[model samples]
Target: MSVGDGRRPEPRYSRIVGELRRRIESGELAPGERVPSTREITRQWGVAMATATKVLTELRHEGLVRAVPGVGTVVSAPERATAHAPAPTAPAPTAPAPPAPAAPVRRSTPSPAAAAGSPGGLTLSRIVAAAVTVADAEGLTAVSMRRVAAELGVATMSLYRHVADKDDLLVRMMDAAIAERPLPADPPPGWRAPLDVAARQLWGLFRAHPWLAPAMSLTRPQLITSAMVYSEWVLGSLHRHGLDDQSAFTAHLTLLNYIRGLALNMETEREAEAQSGLDSEEWMDTQEPALRETLEGGRYPQLARLSRAGYDFDLDGLFEFGLQRLLDGLAVLLDEGTPPTRA
Candidate 1:
């Protein structure tokens, strides 16, 4: 359908292409000069890579840019301007003066401040900070070496000098995020209190960076030192409660799995909200009718009764209830020398 006029409207990417064309035509970006890379376009214009790439591709198709092997894509020499060049005429007095000379291009190097802020020059800490900021604003899927470089205001190649690859960057991000959380030096008088504190701290971190949940894996765990320290703290806390090394390690694994599993759901829910533009409450409202119809059919009488009683399933409440139950089960094992329930 037509948008404003009888003719069909232009696609969004076309508008981006037009603006880029104007920049090249105005000599804001000079001929043979490097154009903004797709990565830079995405960051500066807040467009997806597909859209940004399309803009560059369109420019190439129209002979506005050509790819250079060593450098990147650069503005192409204008054909018409090269063919028909007017000899310089005397400047018109009445005409507005030409704009001031364009500023000199600045070559950005990694700053001493950035290097010093890191433990060593261009250390994992700085790399993680850049990655985390990208994940924080856009979801983790949007994070990559190219994207992180755009965020750091550096070329994509510079990021590779610090991190091996995108996966390495993500592992480092997880490590850096975990390292910020200091483990308690001494366990509380009992295992329950300290474990509870540790679990809550972890939960808070996951909630703060919702993308963190899925980044972690239980099966093939990333060998992150700080993450290992957290496990060590948990195992040591449980060691005093009459559990052997193997059992204590198992307990630590189980507890972490429980927290991570629940946190995963929270992260998924938030991601769904972001993609669909529907908040959790709005999503629940849409599902309520179908849920009520099933629940009220008498197959789930207990659940129906609870629903009718206006029960709300909150993460904090669920965590507390589950934690207490798990602790109770642990207490039973500690007192009676029985094995704890398997997860």
Candidate 2:
């Protein structure tokens, strides 16, 4: 509160930036040491992600920090003053000492504002592309308007010109990603053929971009035009096979759910790998002893027998088997002229 009118205080981001700057300047945060990530900053300062992002942006503008890929932001080495020092001179006893020099404005690292004005300036496509790159490399949780802006070297506020908010940006990202592998121009003859192609294409997209599977919502689906293309294609195929609107759409949804359900594991595996520094095979190897011990107790004879035979967990194989069985069941319904019952 102000003395006179009780006006609001300085922005929370500014105060947070000051505290972080103090830590960096005071050597409390050493060079090459990882600073708190945006998420951590949000928790520590009880501020929003945009505020946390601004704090780091300010630090970078002053050349106190730099972002390291896969390592978050870190304190950079202190700037040496040798290059700007005036010639050494003996001071006269009577002469008044020169007033202390002001701190030089160090804009070593380019600000996002500056980058936003450069050639091929910021656009909606660029914003979505930057966001997708970040999500693909670091998972969905790592993505935010601020983070994407940082990746594009543009002001976080500038992103609003392209997207309404984080949720809007995410929908665009999904739309763009789905658009990457468009449905084939010429559809195959039979219902199963096109359905197979569509399912496989969706799986391919999910495999390539692991974050996409979980970001997608089944309950309240976003209006992503490119994604709707797939739905339209599948529904047409199913309808041509003599199924009613509800039955065809139901079949499409069932197939989509199956593929998405399996793809959900991809992000989980990636998270586990990053956190534990072990891939699926290496992780399974580490757990072999305990797994064998539990199975050997005879609590599960079938699993024990399979364990002795060395079962290899293959997600792709499981997906294929399930897909075929589902198609077979759908084929039976189509042949017998039985409409799918609503759940």
Q: What C-alpha lDDT values do all the predictions have?
A: 0.68, 0.74
RMSD of each: 18.4, 20.7
Candidate 1 C-alpha error for residue 333, in Å: 1.5
For model 1 the TM-score comes to 0.61
lDDT of 2 at 293: 91
Candidate 2 per-residue C-alpha lDDT over 1-343 given as tens digits, one digit per residue, 9 for 90 to 100? 5668867778999888778777765567766676776657877889975677778777777777765322346676554212222222442122121112111111234356655786458888878877777777679989999888887687789889879999999999898888878888888997888999999999878866778999999889999999999999999988887889999988988999999999898788778767986445445556767988999889999989987765545567778888887887787878954453322
Instruction: Provide backbone clash counts, one per model.
Output: 0, 0
lDDT of 1 by residue, 173-257 (tens): 8887777677778767778788888898787667656678889999999989988888877777788777889888888888888
Error of 2 at 96 (Å): 74
Off by over 4 Å in 1: 1-123, 336-343
lDDT of 1: 0.68
